[model samples]
Target chain A: MAVLDRDTINAVREGFTRHRLSWIDTLPFLFAALMYFFAARYLPLGTQVMIQVAFALSLDLALGYGGIDSLGHVAFFGMGAYAAGLYALYVSSEPLSGLAVAACIGALTGLVTGPLVLRARGLTVVMLTLAIATMLHELANTSAMKPITGGADGLFGFKIAPVFGMFSFDLYGRTAYWYSLGVVAFVFIICKLVVNSPFGLAVRGMRDNPVRMRMLGVNVTARLVTLYCVSGALAAMAGGLSAQVTKLVGLDSLAFLVSGNALVMLILGGAGRLYGAIVGATVFVALSDRAAAIDPFNWLFAVGGVLILAVRFAPQGIVGLIADWSQRLGWVRR
Target chain B: MAAPALAIEGISKNFGGLRVSRDISLSLPVGARHALIGPNGAGKTTLVNLISGLLQPSSGRIALDGVDITNLAPERRVGLGLARTFQISSLFPSLTVAENVGLAFEARFGLDRRLWGRVRSRPEIVEGTAALLQSLGLLELARKRVADLPYGQRRLVEIALVLALEPKTLLLDEPAAGLAVSDRGALLDLLLRLPEALTILVIEHDMSLVFRLAQRITVLVEGQVMTEGSVADIRADPRVRDVYLGTRSHG
Candidate 1:
């Protein structure tokens, strides 16, 4: 038998606490990348799912960690899509700069609306976020901006330059797939770093008990707003990636359906855990795509059935369930 | 004595038409141990809330260390060396015990806003958290989630959280409310052993613990102060006895 006293047990556990992501954590990313070599025919579909993962991760940061409960996060996503699409069309076709421009616009949008929407909680927050996204959607739909936004016809006259002025975006979408994967990896790394930092801990604290956090000398609202903007920028970059890869930005980018779908993905995969975003997006996108091909009219029924099963069996999300099993098997200690 | 560590002058609060706290005034001198006792709905918690800036007072001012903080936010007041624990054991339930206390240390050092480095890897936070948990005899449970701990242990964590801030003044709301009879002694011992330089305003119903740890006692009734004096005076006061017997079914 092991003579493990409580103090000795705790000390040992603390010594090896996984505060930062390890090389093993990158295995999933490597696996996702490796899949491209085998599934060349499905590269575009995989790229779209990866973009969804990036977007879902952004939402997870705010809705999962920050307890933001925003239903209109796609506003930033849509804004980024349009910004990148328009920039490539009118200003510069540099893919990197397009992402940066989209991120800035998204961050700016978050900065402007965060204070107002975050001031309220629960249903009010959801409603205000929806209103903001709806307003932006309506603005994009207006005929006055038709000359610029394409006015529901969708923005399509854009030619994105080759990646880093080298590898051209090919017909097979191999470059675009790798490009989206790279951005998603970069964003995922940043998110991991953020959630492990002191700021991340404080955000989690706010989610658990804002009153306690306030009494602990935290400027709760300021932190919330800052997080909102950062998440916004990241989500926008994902949108920019989507625009760059698709060569199209449409009204659907800013649609409530997009926001609702991302939220659904977050819940299906789980929220607080970042990997949940990855798993949720991949599973949802892949299943939905396959289901649509199998029976376009009845695809919703398949997706709904899967969601019901996931909610019933793994309400905490796929990551949470995995975490539980790992802990039980002594493979992980959370 | 040193301009009072905390001073509440003519503070009153009203929710709608019902007055919860009315002209309740109290002074806590530097390094003093004061106890506020009252029956249910007597506004002891309300008064504590007003002092801690959780609830806005309709009238009056609260000064901390010669600084008027009546209009300051709760976080700002905490910056001014005011700390408090909730009656309901407010904690980051999903986080581990060490993380909970570490957050307080992070807050005290103004590192709560640091967005770059890993919190657990910081030597200061890790060492500070260990030292704090060791002192509270909770080093063993550091890895356990706050939500998974027993109710009494959660309360101790609450106290540890506040102590990690190292505030000059602490407002404890029902710190000993639901402890087993056996645990109250340890709770009292912990309270008594706190540094003499820290002024504490404890709202407790445990007369034994209060009478032992508190040097001064202030009794309240129906949102108003009934009396204030030394423990002996408070214990001997017939009015205090009458109020206790009428309000308290069990200690």
Candidate 2:
């Protein structure tokens, strides 16, 4: 205690605050910016990649950072899609307003499902998430809900107001591309804030050892639920963006494959890194588009091959490689 | 008894037909230094688990500062100024030692749910975490990941984490379970120097450490209290020797 005066303690405390946002964190955004400006012809594909990045980023928060293993995250995504779609049909056609509604619905979906899904761990968590997603998918397809959900045919017919009521969603998808990119950027920043925050540290701590966290008076389950809710909201935002951009909410939005694909993207890019989502989504969407165009019937073969290669070579994700490189470069502080 | 800081009344726990704690009762008054010693399979850890709300007793009530908390969640009990260290060191391995201690410190300030900003931006929590680590001689290890630390330092970090809670009642389950002699000496000194008003219940197999730390010692046999008395009384009790003390190698 004698050695720990005000200055000494402050110095030690200063250690925790050592790593702030660095130039390296902005590299991914810079890449995206370059793509936006230089590769404007591929805006439609770029928009799809951004939406997937947003979705995968949300999954990374829940499964990677929060230690919540959800195999059915598409439930929130589909809910967001429907929230935007239904809002457009019955409420207002404004895209921003619809996206906000979608985000709230995603958060609401999380609040409802987090308690049920987060209470379990490992296989049970997976089953519960998958079950919820399946149930949502079935409900959307049910004829009883056909008038509202569009049943199996998909939800459309509602026109989305232009960006700021100026930039229309053109045939080239220029506006939708930029809009989704903005949403993805927003999601990335949120993840960054959370990762550096006390709440994020607590969530990571709980994920590492929940029993120890409980002993420290941390309501582990409650914190987890909150994280799940946030992740859900973000995932829903991605869904809403998809609906607005594509102008269609399909049964596939809630499909199990979507959740599986999101997980794949996260795993391939690295689960916990914010940039991992960006890298994963961009790579996944690009690969899918090329494979589908080259050989439409067996595009899964290309995805499956890439996934296997990613799993075998870089199990920690592509972002993990960058981290190692940064460390080896002798410039990264931590 | 000056309003005991912790009271366990007729606490009993069973696993199907097997009973781990049987009608056990103990009271630790405020500022009391109490130790519970028992032979292996005597359910010493079970009693600690029951008190800490990790395991529920089939029939018993656990109270902290005179409030019954028989059904409180483990985290709820911790919120009411109860903290504990496990016999085996448990920590967030990937995080730095500062982060581990900082998480506990922030939780005390009800900042665990604040999601918007960086945790280190807060001056109070950072200094509090630093002061706690510095006091424990763990300042140099602040940035090191817990997974890379040696076993001895891990135990010290566990203590740091527990103390960050500023608990009124502390439960140390073999605080020096696997430490070397030098580490054990350090731990003994640390335990002896804890706040005078903090009630402590330490479960240990090391008799010398127990003797130096406990004002009163309770010996348990088969999940039931065999004897409860001052340190001298337990040291001289032949039955305690026959059941527990005699069975283990003396320090």
Candidate 3:
């Protein structure tokens, strides 16, 4: 707790300085590097958790900053997973190129659907997003797509080139883990820069009072649609990372359960605060992994109880609650 | 001949078979201070909405600088140098006062699309916001979130945001509503201090404020123009006294 308090102080100070990275901002990358060097046994799980955190960050930008409440964000994730897998099989074996392809596909999907979907607010938007994701899921499961997507069997049998022609993806998964960490660090920095920019503030303004933002000459809907696409691309990149690291793409990536779990993780960590995604994803994923190992049926109850407690007590998520406490303690102003 | 800053002809609004605003037409040449006053439910807000393009006129032609703008969107109208303040003090509550004003400056500068640079690091936006906050006596509260401000300060912040747009035609919907008696003077001072060349239309119920600020006053009754005259002419008009003013004393 004292460590977190110190980190919070540094984070606030860094926020005011603008564009400069502080120890707190770079701590995740440092921690990931340290873990890779020392706790090598847990690298695979760490990689998975980083990908999940990336997914959470994407949702944070949309639902938290843009006020785009979505229930089918996993559509982009699943699409990216498939796109990455397909690219490796049919187009290229280079992992980085596959990831880029996946990102573009995800962004294209958002660009195509964002206008039609973002026009509605509240539950209608949720329903539309859910419908689109479900449609993709069904299409992937169909017999026509079985040869390509592998149907319920999932897609496998793809090779990823070594990292910079040096680090081969070993059977122990060390290379994959480091690659995932690098991607997460890059995406995190990008998300940080985005939310701190004038464009980002405009998004928040639109979320608060779109009518007023429109009066300020902001193309509110257009801005939101653009944000949605960017978020979609980021989410897809996370999914691509997962597919590349695991060497498999599953239909479950697009399922409502994936979307729901990501949302639960975000809310548990507290939404809006970027680092909340990291905290929530790590805690939720690690806890769920342990809980499922102990008792699969009882795990749901434990997850539900934690979510309830998190919502009731730490409504801002752990990060937000900590920030509030720091403010009360006179450690930070915001 | 120079075009009127704003011109509305035969404007009307209906909601599901019920007419809220009847054929209302008015003109404001450059630098005109026009005030629209009416009793409650007289569609004053609806007319403002129509002019601001928040509501489409059932039938009318609205123009900005002689260009027909009846079909333009609200944001497009804003792009054409038109802006309005809300009666309800619409603002980004979670953001700091400086950030709110900075957003306005960024929008005016067409820098709102910039997604890479940190907003606070931009000298033009920072200096402009500080100057604006200082002008409104809100310099000390610049770093304070809008939600933390008093009601009057929040209203001033709203107007400050509007002013940051450097708009040519400003529509203020009850800018003085909810302000304390003492605060109205500050509000009045702020409005009176604006550049005279900036065209302004105020929708206010405060008669003294209206008379003090407006060069021309238009009174509406049941969505139609009841009278159009100077402040003295409005005070003398018997129909305005009987229908609009009635027994309520002017503040």
Which DockQ values do the candidates obtain, in the order shown? 0.54, 0.67, 0.48
lDDT, candidate 1, equals 0.89
| Candidate 3, A1-334: lDDT as tens digits | 1122433333222323243467788787888889888989888889889999999999999998888989999999999999999998888888888889999999998999899898788799899999999999999999999999999989899998887878889988888888998888877887888888888888888888888898999888788888998899999999999899998998998899989998999899988878899999988988887888899788887788899999999999988898899999999655
Among incorrect, acceptable, medium and high, the docking class of model 1 is medium
TM-score, chain B, model 2, is 0.98
Ranking by TM-score: 2, 1, 3
Candidate number with the higher DockQ (1 or 3): 1
DockQ versus reference, model 1: 0.54
Q: Candidate 2: misplaced stretches above 4 Å?
A: A1-11, A14-19
Q: Write the per-residue lDDT of candidate 1 for residues A1-334, one digit (tens) a residue.
A: 2233556444723732344678867876887778888878899999999899999999999999999999999999999999999999999999999999999999999999999998788899999999999999999989898888898899997999999999889999999988998899988988988898889988899999999999999999989998999899999999999999999999999999889989989878999988899999999999999999999899989879988888999999888788888999999645
TM-score of chain B of each: 0.97, 0.98, 0.97
Q: Would you list the clashing residue pairs of candidate 2?
A: none
Candidate 2 DockQ, CA atoms: 0.67
> Which candidate tops DockQ?
2
Return the lDDT, model 3, position B187.
95
- Given candidate 1, what's the lDDT at residue A74? 91
